[model samples]
Target chain A: MIINHPLLGPRDAQEFTYLGDASLISRPDAQDDNAAEKFHDYLYLRDNPAGLHRELWFHESGDRSWLVVTRNTVTHEITDVQLARDVARKEGRSK
Target chain B: MRYSGFKVIKEALTGHKGWTPQWRDPEPQSHYDFVIIGGGGHGLATAYYLAKEFGESRIAVLEKGWIGGGNVGRNTTIIRSNYLLDGNEPFYEFSLKLWEGLEQDFNYNAMVSQRGILNLVHTDAQRDAARRRGNAMILNGSDAELLDVEGVRKLYPFLNFDNARFPIKGGLLHRRGGTVRHDAVAWGYARGADMRGVDIIQNCEVTGFKIEDGTCLGVETTRGYIGAGKVGVSVAGSSSRVMEKAGMRLPMESHVLQAFVSEGLKPVLPGVITYGAGHFYCSQSDKGGLVFGGDIDGYNSYAQRGNMPVIEDVAEGGISLIPALGRVRLLRAWGGIMDMSMDGSPIIDKTHIDGLYFNGGWCYGGFKATPAAGWCFAHLLKTDTPHDTATAYRFDRFRTGHMIDEKGQGAQPNLH
Candidate 1:
């Protein structure tokens, strides 16, 4: 299945339970950074500081800034995104 | 009193006569909490707002050139909230509010004259668009007046009435919009930010950033590598180069926009005027000079110099609007590089990389949007979430079908 862009973790393209337009969840294959790309714009999977995830982000506006996406690698869909911010904290990345 | 005045004058003259004292260079800081890339209006204003909002007073605004040496100083300084697009309306309206209070906020005289801005519509389609925009403004709680040809003639009697080439029709009058001192805006924000303990670094070019393991730690400047917790890239024209240093290619075009001024005359035009059909807009400055400009050089060049074509086009449109300006001698003209985006709005959000934020692609309206942009950018950097209006300006909105393409030419301006 498709996963997050290699650079920005799995959160960029997470799958979610279909929420209404108010849901801030991201879609697996949709290339939007605003989390409006989710299935009806709902958050499906929640991120756990306990586990690692893969995400995909597509910078569609062409501003060159990448969207830090996070998603579940198993389901192959997007859940959340932190565009321009890294997946792990500064300390976490070094390790 | 006379002797005191003479003594002050003598001291000032002595100060000036003594070997043309060199300006003091800013001392390189060991480290700063935040480092802004550009020293233009946005950078200085961002520093000011950062200090104001977050109480994090230790910020530095680094510039390759002197302050206001970029688009901040090069713009024609027209302030208006006449935008018809969804993404630009609220942001510009907030800027208008800030402009109204800039004097008290910055404690500097910006000479903000809200003499109203008028956009003339020569075609029926344009008139309808103007009407729709005016109605939208009313619905959004902003002020706009839809004036007929007679109303426009009554307001601006000097406009050429019978000229055949797209003769004067009605206009969309925004009474709250106007002009301000562009230089003082940069200076005011600099002074205010500096007062709040933010370092205003000039002539210090950032060579590159210090990135490791896909996270930005700090920047590598001409001076040296300075460590930082967060970095805000407010560089407008140099966005591509800056992002490239971090291994990113932005969909941006570097274009040169030119502004011209004519010989000073008696006060003629009272407010900023724009011709929709002719692609020309102008405003009579406080000094009585007709300040105006049109589109860019239509090529991707960083050079801040324009040719005769734009000058001719702008002047021709000016002459069409006011036949009397044909005799006036052109005085001075200049150009600045604009970091035009695929969509005409700005991008103010965090990047995929950790600790790297951006605020660029403002187009022609960046001058007036300075305050609101700085505020929103500051909020984003502090909270890690986009503000209300800027939420639509995210980098991923394009692929998700949420593009706020106000001037819906789509793709890019040149291609569209």
Candidate 2:
């Protein structure tokens, strides 16, 4: 059901992450500090790399606000991150 | 006998063996206190309320087929009171309150669940709309919350979080909305009203009404002529057909609304989830089957069968929400025609006829609003005064421009 477009890579199960359940927003227990940010939004990886050549590549995080995440596609190492608008403009793609 | 909860215990100790009638002859009574047509939820509810309010027991609820066999039973059993418009919010809130206590009132297990309903937003604009709706719920004294993408992931882990087409941006969480047993709702009201000495004459379709001067004097059913002082038309989908008999035409279109069920699973979804971007919504029934429905057919048709386009749209939306549903085979699909009105809100007011009343134009919210609709329609029947919330849902609102345009697209049948 996770159909990755031609521009996007196929969904890999290993890349998925479980931040928490989907009901924290409705619960009064989530009103405390950091729960709104850490537990409010859920994150999941759509891929599980099968190759040995580990390359750290950055991609948009598929949210409304564009994100630039630097992570190993194979070894899954986090190296760099920023908003796509901030990082891409610095790289002279602001035509 | 006073009306109480659902269970009824007969008492012989107080000379109160219920009302002993003269069993008057079936002769056209010439004038009845009240006559309600269309024995669906609305009509029956109206009768029950009328008796309770006005001490008027001379009410007859007429039906064409077996009572409760209409859209009352065919609806996809979902209930929610979270509305965004002005006129709709209060009416639905009344309905939600009735649903919460329906089991105790009807003495029948309606299987009403507060399993919650999630409207998943996929874009910034959709998130804004969801936020507005959530705020509207709060303003109307209903519980609602705005959920972010992370909030959605934490709750529904099975969704495709990475898919750009329907990325989990956020959602509007209505904690009180859920599903109910559709048929039990009809049966409970029927048995309860029947116990109250309301004569339920089924299989007697009203072919025509006897009009005297400008007032509806009586009804001419297939069985025979029946006299009544007041008549209420609570037919949902058949509003056009029945109204045409009175020389009145409605701004209504008839189309089938279909629901699909998948093979029983281990109950993956705990509540109903509606795709804000697509016409897909689903909830797990008590029997572990996934009961879901989507948009109505754009064209007018009486056929209860649907085509492939809506099926594909709903399936794709379902798969987007829960990736695991792709493995579950769809058990079946069926349809019911909706009485979609021009303004999307319902019309529960007196017609131009002096003695005739109407309660139609519920659109998709018919099932959820059945109880409150009955209550209000009954109030109108007894006092001839409109409820404060439903005053603007009149037939004249279409021309006066006082429309309750819920979708904000003006008067159109496809208000989804």
| Best TM-score among the predictions, by candidate number | 1
Give TM-scores of chain A for all candidates.
Answer: 0.29, 0.31
Best by lDDT: 1
**Model 1 chain B worst lDDT run, 10 consecutive residues:** B16-25
Worst ten-residue run, lDDT, model 1 chain A? A14-23
Give the CAPRI rating of model 1.
incorrect
Candidate 2 accuracy as lDDT: 0.72
- Alpha-carbon lDDT, every model: 0.73, 0.72
lDDT of 2 by residue, B1-416 (tens): 33443213444444556644322213234456788999888887787767765567888888888878988888888899889987889888888998998888867778899999998888899988888888888888888999998988888888777787667788889989999998888877776676666777887889998887889988999878888888889988778778878877666655568889888888688988987767888889899899988887543445556556678878887787778888899998987877777667889999899888899988877999988999999888888999876777787776556878888765546444
Which candidate's DockQ is highest?
1
lDDT of 1 at B31: 84
